[model samples]
Target chain A: MKRAASRLAALSLALLAGTPAALPARAQDAPPATRPSDDQAEVLAKVEKYLELAKSGTAAVRPQAARRLAQLGEPARARLVELAGADGAGLAELGPQVVEIAADFGDAGLRAALWRVLADADFPWRGSAARALAKAPVADEGAAFRGLGADHLWQVRFAALDALRALDLRDARAAVRALLVDQEGAVRRAAAALLVDWGEPGALRWLVEELRREDAYFRVPLGAQARFDAHKRLTELLGDDFGFRPGESPATPANAAALARLEAAARERAGDAWPSELPPIARAAGASTGDVLGLELRSCRAGEFYLRWNDADEVHVGTGNAAVVTLAPGTVERLRAGIERRVAELGDTRFWGEAGCDLEQYRCVGADGELRTWLLSKGQASEGDLRPAPLDAVAELLLLTLPDEASADPRLDRLRSRARAALSVLGGAL
Target chain B: MISLRSLLPALLLVGLGAAAPSAEDATVVQMVELNNVEYQIGDDLPDWVIALDGQRIEIAGFMRTGTLEGETWFDLTNDSCGCGTSKLQHFVRVTLESGTTSFTPDELTLTGTFAAGEQEDEDGFVESIYRLTITSL
Candidate 1:
């Protein structure tokens, strides 16, 4: 009976995070400690247990538990963020879960928790946490983010730049201004994006610069053997937060024309930059050598780190040119940027707004389309694969993901054989 | 060599020609319904994505199945692709419904048309996600 009651209490707490949790304190009312709200205690107790379990579950029962606690609402936010960011923390492992819980918390708790997350060492997690706080449910939520303008982790601090978009309070101008000069192109872009909205003094120039880097560094080629996090999208981008809603009106004619113009302009712009598309660093290697690629700052490769999006100028396997690519100096940096951008765009509430999908877990799918059994989790991407392969086709395939037992794994063998066989056939045709 | 520069003109020509000899502007696709079977992300990975079931779905141009969900539905029609190349058709996934009543399936393919946005406004990053007729199992 007690367990059932506790479970019910936890469930209620989860629901409270979404709807209002009756924050009835008329300034004269007593605090929880004095009154002993039975509900808060039950939730706290259950949530603590959930956090502990979140550490050991095999297929991720614990992560789900943390999510449930998140649903319980505001009171649990402090606990959730604390545990999710524990020292020697596995931010990547706990990233998706932390974001999930953060999204579930109320503005009061979220605003504070998101602040701490902004300075976290982990880029992926910080980015996720920042994006969550961007659309925070309350006003003046920018305080925590303001200090993050100079966080140590590049991605984490970068996320702080992104957080400014929705949380751009008048007082937060200093933070946004500082980020505008950030070394990372993504940081500058986010800072500029917010400046555009805020109409800050001299932000467009910075935005343009960031945009320049975005286009130039966007599609730098992958080296012969480059492996990045292929499981980020699986955890962060995937999920059921299907952004569609009912009762949406039809698109206006003007809207159609505008979208077309954007498409055409993007094409023209990408084409113009085809010659020097990538940064010089990315161009130093194999198939990625001197490809006329353009860039767009979005997520790819499982939303892990960004990929300097390099393109083959519309090279199609069947279009006679099996595969050709070019790269520049910052191709790898651009790739990393893509990952960062993708991580931030997931739940902006600005573009898709209320329509973003509810993020769940991450997964890994191969070229032939198979969800990798393990190594798909967000945590795995952060610290697991430290060895970088040489640049090459086999390298490209390997980068899609690294099999646990490269020799014994059927997925790796299948990918290797198919890629080799395909390349061989293509090479023969060439 | 046919560069993307050259290809765009050709693609534009095709687009303009496809507008018909009726001396008028051009046309388009959207996802409306499904029933009885499971939702498949794409032909290659035939698995149901439950979140998209029944609920109206909207997505970007190119989509790969990931465990995380937000904008879970991305239509791979011409302009929607992030790749800006032949869509791997790989950027595909579908939500399934069980028998007309609920969405539950082993595998289902998404077939839909998107409301192409106009290309003229300053704040015109607008693309409205529309109805997807569910083909449930």
Candidate 2:
């Protein structure tokens, strides 16, 4: 996998270098005209200045830099593409802004570089590349867009739909329709909105139904955001909100009435074409029982870990792949009660620390079957002293449940030691 | 029993009382409210959001950073992927008043005094429309 990724990265660099064979056929296929020496020096200075600003300035300033680079025309763009090639690993960090700059240029060479990034499976910014590709003219991109629409990551698939919409490729209707049942709720909503724009009135049912969704990752209200996005899209496209307020709890009587009115309006719009049954609401994959509690720590560079315990005295633990082990009788009940008490004392805060690339996510199914979630930065727990008290205690308890034989596994042993150290700092026994 | 070490910060804040805002005093704000509006550089922010200026607020979001070490400031964004059009309104530029924070991959809750309005840099580029100043992690 590493070798394959390296080769793809190299190929992307080659494309950016404007190798003759790598160039796509377009009316503006010629390389950007070279500037006079003094003008070249001036452009180079401007590029250096903007690139430095993009690196040091506020994150919002990166877009401004991208605009300035776009205004500098092709020499600056060639320099950026060269910089991207020299530091392939930094591409993930710089890809979004660089791609945005490329999107503004009418240069075919720049678009070709985007295609290479989009095609490389290991590229971290494929979604950004896909969205950027939308601004440039499309030529044999239908197959590529369709393939990206089926990418494993919902973000990539979502961006592909957006690209198709921007390109106004009405011929891709079948491809968009297939995504109405996408596994991710947000993607499904995006697909529905796109199809509705294509004059498919029946697709309005998906948006109407999404307004009533209450799916959550613990207490995060992910579904609420999805509903909000759907509502916003519907309002922008149709200019009528039907009184559906996304901030209100979906289960509230007021939202229920609003949803009914929205559904009626959708049905009227669909006329005889409304489906007899709506597609099932998409949900994240996991155990949904009220008796289950799961913690997932995901670090893209370091790998991922998951621990799940339930009422049946079963504990599932894994890094990458999971193993289920039955715990000692009555252990689950005791641990669950203790953890519940600690969580309650932690209060209503749903997330801790500022966002980063790594995550420490805790999800527990409450007695009422509502999933309550808490999120903390994984780095916050890297040190024993800084680990959140409630999370440390819960993690320690869960670690203790591992049988003595678990120590035989190196990964499990490391986790156990880490939890032990954290608990000790809190003056708790494991 | 809760650890005294973990409770020290809250205890110290209580001991100080009205001298500063406690964690409990921070109004919990949702990222949705800040990002719901599509804002350009020169456009006026919604009145509801502008009302939050200088108020102690707590908000949750993912941090965007190029590095994980010795960072005194970072951008907090609602979406992790940062796909679609990234306008000036999409991020809240957070500056720590004292110590720096390392980057973490999980969702974070930050409590601080918020300033809402467009602020430009030397180049006339809008740096951020919303800003936050926090004392510590």
Candidate 3:
């Protein structure tokens, strides 16, 4: 439980240091001289045995105890909950250790107990329960998130918000939007950032206004620069220079003038309904609702370049010549779907094996407003003859971007067909 | 090239100066220092690195072979697992003076002479930013 508390505090983004001992658990409220009866002693012994088996057992043996505990149903649930509510000294240290195992139980009765703890106004374990739920696959995800978000504690609320962000639940959009005015600065920041990521309509305006506030100052460290986090996100959403330079003070006369100019530009752009002529980054950040994608290629052997489709339906591939070609009608939507499918294949794994001389990189801006990059390399492992090879489809796409005279060789015809087959899943005459 | 024996006399005459390090003293160059963002992006290695050109130094990193055969002269990188994006200065060339030693997957600690420059092939792609002639491994 202590470790869970510390992890929650660190992930809160509230700029607060957590001391494990300072936070009291439910055991602190109980009378000191109370002794366990025979039934309670048996329950405690069984809980300890199950915890030990879960911790030290191998993959084959571990699931047996975990399953048995889950099958024990209500009795196991009650004992584990009591242990989790224990103080953070000696044996109580086991409280944090048993959370993942207990979650693996995935029993309805146990899950109900956890939900009760989460919803309980008197329980001091709400933060711990919310955090465990964030990692666990709960059945009533939407309802659990809603309840946790409304908790009185800021830490619990922040954890719930983070869970909502990771799940990217479209159904909970209204609830998430309500958190934009949260009392804690960290919660408000997280809410605004998640809204921007989902391409919500009013998110950009809220972010800009946050930066323009009189109390706004750089309180968080971002890379080499010390600008307000809102300002940084705004720059990422809009262009790098979004109408004004970030000066040292928000109250300075020069800064105020610059901000006025920025606000004027924003208001004018918003009035136009955000035409597609704006930058691709701006369009991805919800400035406009048309199709604009970023494509980048980097190689140790063939060199590096970026490609993007402009508002005029022209694709610019920077292949030494800055080559521009017009795409056929309906090709843009097909391309967007193609990119989305490719990104889904690269979820948690970006690159595999060691670096090789022949390395190729492919990047794309997905239709869902997220940027994805993948690396394909030819690598030989330490002891094996088996070597890793680059993706053939991506290599063919790369060849298409190069100059026609060099890439138009007849030998590439087979590969080109394969590449088109992979990229053109929508299947028309592009 | 100035021999290690010849640089010693010059160091004694110059006498323990902070600006110029003698060849006898082993300098340690961190990967973070070599990849400093302050350096200008260009074909040539910056002048600031030239101070440690001929000096012996010790560096620790992961080993990677240039070809499938796994030769003795390999590229050492900041990340052994090859998990993230890489830049030019993230690798240093290490050549074994005593010929091919067995390649090991573990992180290797090496002592060698540090050489700073940009070497390109006939196609003019940057081959390296730093090179080391191994004295010990």
Top of the candidates by TM-score:
2
Write model 1 residue lDDT over B31-73, tens digit each, in one string.
1111112222223211222222232333322222222243333
Q: lDDT (CA) for every model shown?
A: 0.34, 0.64, 0.48
Off by over 4 Å in 2: A1-40, A52-58, A81-94, A283-430, B1-27, B56-87, B95-112, B134-137
- Per-residue alpha-carbon lDDT of model 3 for A1-430, expressed as tens digits? 5344333322221212244344345333434343244564454455546666544432222334444555565556655544554331222233323443455455444455556655654333345556666766443586768666766555577778777876777677888877765544455656767776786635555555544433210111111121255566666665554444342344457666766766565555456443334222111111112325543332221223345554455555432112455666766556556655655655565554344323334445565555454544443222232112233433343435333433432212243343333222211112
Q: What does candidate 3's lDDT look like per residue over B29-110, in tens digits?
A: 5543464423322655545466557767777665542212335577776433332223457677788776665444335667
Q: Each candidate: fraction of true contacts kept?
A: 0.00, 0.26, 0.06
TM-score for each candidate, following the candidate numbering:
0.36, 0.65, 0.29
What's the i-RMS for candidate 2 in angstroms?
A: 7.0
Model 1 ranges off by over 4 Å = A1-71, A74-97, A100-124, A131-147, A150-159, A162-190, A193-430, B1-63, B67-137
Interface RMSD to the true structure, each candidate: 17.8, 7.0, 20.1
Candidates sorted by lDDT, descending order? 2, 3, 1
Can you tell me the CAPRI class of model 1?
A: incorrect
lDDT per residue for candidate 2 within A267-344, as digits (tens), equals 888898787876433322332233367766544233345567778887655411234568888888788777788789
What's the alpha carbon RMSD for model 3?
A: 28.4
